[model samples]
Structure formats: structure tokens, C-alpha cells
Target: MSLIKKTFKTIDELKKHLKTHAPTFYYSSQTSTVIPYDKIADFFKNKEMTLGDLSQLPCSMELTPTQNLIVKGAISWKDAKDFLRSKKRNIMTSPTEELALISAGAATSATGERCFHFGNLRSQIISLTYLNFDGNEVKLNQDIALKNTSNEVKKYQKDYAQYDIFKNAPFPRLETQTDLMIGTEGQLGIITEIEIKTTDDFPVNHLFILLPKWEVDSKAHLEIINKVQKFRNMVILCELIDANSFEYLPKADRPNKEMDAIFFEIKTQSFNDFYEQFVLNLEYIDQDHVFELAATKFHNIRASIPRAVFEKNSQMGVVKKGTDVQVSVSQFETLLKIYQNFTKLGIKYNLFGHFGDAHLHFNFMPLPNQVELCHEQLELLYGHVLKLNASPFAEHGIGIIKQKYIPAFWNQNTFKVFKQLKDEHDPYKQFFPQGFMSLEDHS
Candidate 1:
């Protein structure tokens, strides 16, 4: 599609623009993981669409220290962190994309490294302001306090359990309009501002534990991960760096090229506390294979893998294809077995991500000729994943690229309910015309 890109500096400007020209799509400022570039390029080639940019919306933030943060949607994660740091407070869990807009993360239900304990982006949100299809501003707030212990929230989850698409998603299900608006990928509304809960910014440290050769020592690697699983209380994030992903990292960042690694973060009050609670207690973890790094440096090293993957895809002129499925812990072993099939097919790939949550990203770096094969394999894999009742698009919301898979995920009745909800909220279908469910007449 030929996209007419426009940016608005204020909500008033956006409202004015909407009155004149209806935007068919909306995306954040950065072309980070949030944007579905391949879907837009391939699926809308013959269509002309106006793509609205929400990133330039006026920046404003109010921190209540240990309470909550009321911030404009356009505020970047880095800026939010900086502001919170000044007050000795921060979002309990933050997504890895520091440059991404916080509103984008909440809208897409993006998860952070510490998601296993603190929960995903949705957990942080207390209330949000969004513009509907008519460009009228509306705010949705949690009826009760933002706590999982609320009976209303639990009852809502139990009532809507049948319609839940992502089975293993974090708590606070579709209880209110706020829950519905989140993870809708702009299909419901354009998020303008958000109020999210915060926590004290305590100091922490990282542990990088090396593994034996992954391909040969697969059993050993799984056993190591099982060990890490027992220490969830102290560990904030338990990530896996498979051999394929390790190769893509810069030589300067890697400990060595010889082994895969299990990287995790832990609370660091003092040296003795760390040694007693984590170091000495984690059996089978040899001191020779383990080391520590500062949080900032460790994050940089971890972020490099995804950056390298995207760079390689760009260089090869191939569209990025990756899995974001999250299943129950019991099904994770099966998921790993399916990933191993990539070797049998001789497809070059990388597998890494939130090992603790049973959510991992498996990216395919196929040559032009191998793209078709990759698509076939992905379809088969997703089919298997659905059988396990996994959240097929776990961290990443279903943008245009993954919309085709929704039919299998949602029942006919559930699909109709969502369509009806969309019709009620956006009768004109002016917002995100062909997302989640296509309402446009391309013919």
C-alpha cells in the first residue's frame, strides 16, 4: 500500500486531522517490534491508506512515587524510567524496548524481563485515556483497586474463561473496557494517556551461567533450566541464549563462543545475602561457569541479539518471521521439541527469550527461496501450539500478519462477540480498518 504518513504534536491536532481525514492505521514513533512492517507492505500493496503517528503527542508525566504514574501516551520508556529514577521509583516490570512508547506497550500487552513475577504491561495499568472512532476522548478505569485479589476481577476471569484466546496470559482478564482496549492493537481505540502503578527502584544484579554445547547437551540445558525454575522468588528474569542466538552476538559482548547460557537477574541487597540466597543454594551451578555483570551492561548485551537478527533480515531483504507463543509449563518441553525440527529442515534460525514464562521467540532467517518453506513450517507449528491452548501471539499482539490465525484461536461465537463489540465502539470502522478483523471492502 502507499501510506500517507502524518504526525500530530497534540491531541487537538489529531482530533482536527481526524475530522478531515480518517486514518486507516496508527503506530508508535519507533519502528520497533510494535510495528508490523511486513504485513503492511505485503497485504496492502494495492490500497492507499493514511497512517497516523501518535508518537509526537504532547509529553506529560506525574509520578506518585509508590502509588501510580499518570503519563501521556507519547512518553517514551526511557524518559519514564529517567523521571521515575529521579523520584527513586519505577514501573515494577518494564519491556526490553526502552525506546518504545509506554502506551504502545500497554496497548499491545507487551511483557518485560521481570514479567514472571510482576506480570505483563496490562498489570501495570490502572486507567487509560483513548480516542474512539469518532475522535471523542474517553477514559476507562479499573472499578476496584489494581489488585488480583479483587473478587470482581476473579469472577470476571472465571466468567470469561471460555472466551479467553490466550490461555496462559497474565492476570486481570477482560473485566472492564480497560481490559478490552488493551491488546486490541488499536482496533478498539487510540490510547492517548495512561495511569500505571509503580514501585520502589531497588538495586539488582545479573548472573550469566554458561552451558555446554546446546545441540549435543540438550538434556543438560533443559535440566539447568529446571534448576533455575526453582529459584523464581529471587530471580527476576530467567532468559535462555541458545547456541544459534549466541553466534549472532558481537564477539565483545559474548563470554565465549563455546556454549549456550542461562542469564538471570536477582535482588542484590549485599554480597552475603546474594551468596546465601542464590549463589550457594543453586545446586549443580558451578562457580567456574557463573559470573556477574551490572544491570545496564547486561541489558545491553541481551538487547544486541534481537538487533542483530533484525539487521540480518534487513541485509538479506527478507521479511522477519518469528514465533511468540506462550504455553503452560507442561507443554514447554513439547514446544522445544518442535523448535528442534528447524535443524532437520536445514533452516537457519535463532531461539531465545523469556524461558521462565514458557514464552520464547523463535525467529527464522531464511533465504528468499526458503521463505515459502518457512511459512509452511510455521503454520504447522502454530497448529500444534493451538492444540496445546497456548497464547499464539503471546507478547506481541496480533497485528495484520497474525490476523489470519485468529479464526482457529477464537470460536465462531467468540469471534462474533468481538466483532459486535468493535461495531458498537467504532460503527464507522474508521480506526484500523483492516486489523484483527477486516471490515474494509477491498473489492
Candidate 2:
């Protein structure tokens, strides 16, 4: 009866357990279907179905003397960071590390925007082990798989090269087969274990800048970002907060009326150089001498904005919907224009995020009755993003919620390739039955 205590070491055992106890369909009391366990039968017929409870798996880490870490997928980010810190090793911070810790067979920080601080989670992965739909385990490493999948890799690149959005955009290099899995969004397989490259622990310098709305126009912000790019190697984090976000902050901590803020974390060694080169007409409302505490405080503030929006909406019986959109650095001004247009329409929204990478999170808070209007606005906004050749789902993976928007990003041919990739790896759609492109869409 206790699912947490159950463990299935072999594929056959797992299959057998599931076939017997797992429900064919499990629905949430409120909205959508919660689980579709019956789909596994599509891949394996009459197998003894055993379901392994991954949550029961212990979190462990193996650290080499050199500081490289091999961590189990179920390990919490905070626990992993604490372990590394105990050994006097560096800890990389992914967005909301505690809440969005890496998932088994699932990738973290898949987008280029959030990874601006730390390298892409995929890039740091030296190797990984995953489970295919048939319950078979497959291990892959960066070097060997690259050579084996060279032709398919080339074709994948060539296909995307034809699209202006992907062709002109500054994409991170995909040097290995492991790299392709970074943004796969759990479609290919479930990642169980990961070997990651580590860095030498270094101190950081945190700085905060508050700019009045009039003074921090698109052109001025772009100029500041261009100057900051010179120290890209040293700059670990760069985030922008809009005026709407101040509602969550303390009255004393808030920026001036009609003003927004930018937070920066750079390696201490480059602090003086950054301070000297980065000249902007903004007020420094606060600066911290203690970098660690300052970075934590700023990160917490950034994390709280969403929760604040949700709580505020709940009290008013409204719902808040948010979208992540990213454009090439060249289209930063265009993206801002879209945001301004939305604001002019008198929509209640919050705009902020990693402007260094031209990724912004736009949240629309609408009453339950106004949900249709909010969605309509989102559709128009996405159309503009598409016109700019920007990605509507930038950092977040296109899970079930975003499935309806896929047609805008992919053509019939491109979508066909996506279906082929999914079918080849998971023909029965046993894993994450609703994520990425849906089975119904592929059919």
C-alpha cells in the first residue's frame, strides 16, 4: 500500500508490479489527468508491471579529490551544494535551486538565459545514465556518443539552420551528443545519474543599481549591457527587476517611484574593472560589502516575486499566468517595445528577468472571469515574439501547458522530425505522456 517503500531493481520486476497495481488512468480532482500508467502496456505487452518509486531512492554524491562530483539525479540542489561546500568546493547556483532541484532523467537550467551565471547544466555533465521507454538503461558519455551520432547530429543542425530564428540566434555550442540532451525537456529519456565538471571555489562581488524608468530606457540599458559583456567571463549573474516587482519588497528596500533595479554578481577579482568600465546614470540605492549574504538576499527577493503574485491573486479570487520569452540580443529593444505595448493596454502584469540574455518573464494577473482576455492578450504577445523570431518558451520546457503553442514555433517538416525523435525513443509515449509534443499531435 505504501508506494514510497516499493523498489524495483530490474526492468521485469518494475514492469510486473505496474501491470498489476498501477491504474490505467488517474485524474486530479480539479483540472487535468494526473497519471496515465496504462500507456506502458503499449510498449511492453503482458509484462509483470512493477512501479519503482524514485522518491525512495537515496541521494548520494561521489566526489573525486579534484572536486569533480557525480551526483544522483534525485539529490536536492541544496543538499548537493552543502556537500560540495563541506569539502571546500565550488557550488553552482541554478535558479530557485531548492524548489527546482534536478529531476531524474530531467534536465535543469536548459536555457541559455539562466545558465548565464553557471555554465549550462548539460555542458557540465561529463556523462549520464538514463532509462528508455522499454525500461532498458542506457549510459552515455560526451566523447564517445558524439562520434557515433555524428550524422544524425549534422542533420539536426542542418534542419534548424534553415530557420532564421535558430540560424541568427546566438546558440550555445553543442559539441557532444550529451549536449543535445540539455534542452530535450525529458522527451528522450529519464536521467538517473550525472557526472559534472566542477570549478575552483571563488569569492564573488555583488552590486545593485536602481534606475528611474525614464533614465533606464531600452537604448540606455542596451549600452550598459554591451559594456558589461566585456567582462562576461567574470560576471556570474545579471538580473533586471521592473517597478511592478517592488510591491513584494519592503517599503525601505523598494526603488524610487517609476524606477527599476538591476542586480549583478561578479568575481571579486574583476569588481574594480567592472565598476570602472560600467558607467550608467543610475542611483546605487544599496551596495553590500559581504557578497555571499548580498547575493542570497537578492536571489531570495527575485524568487519571492512569483509567490507574492500568486498570493495576491488568490486573495482576490484571480489567477496569475506567466510566460517566458527570449529573443536575440539584437531584438532586446523590440522585446521591450512589446512589454511597453502590453502595459499601455492597462493589463495587470509584472515584467522582469535575465536581461543579460534577452530573456524576460511576463506574468499576467487576471480575475477568474478575465482569463479569456488574458489568454487573448498572450496570443497577440506571442505573435509579436514570433515575428521577432523569439522563443515563447525560452527557459521553461514546453510541457503539457505549452503544447498548444508548438505549431507557432515549428513547421510541418520540423514538427515531423520532432515526432520521429520521440517515436524512435518512446514509441508508446510511456514516459511523460503529455510533455513536449503530445501523442495526439504526432498522430
lDDT of 2: 0.58
**Residue 178 CA displacement from its true place in model 2, Å:** 2.5
TM-score of 2: 0.78
Off by over 4 Å in 1: 32-35, 38-42, 144-173, 270-284, 439-443
Model 2, span 227-342: residue lDDT tens: 56566787887777778877777777654354676778788998887776563322332333112337667767777775577567667654446767777777777777777776
lDDT on C-alpha atoms for all candidate structures: 0.72, 0.58
lDDT of residue 35 for candidate 2: 20
Q: Candidate 1 on 25-115: residue-level lDDT in tens?
A: 8788545453556556555567777778888888899976556988885888788889988988877666776787888877777776778
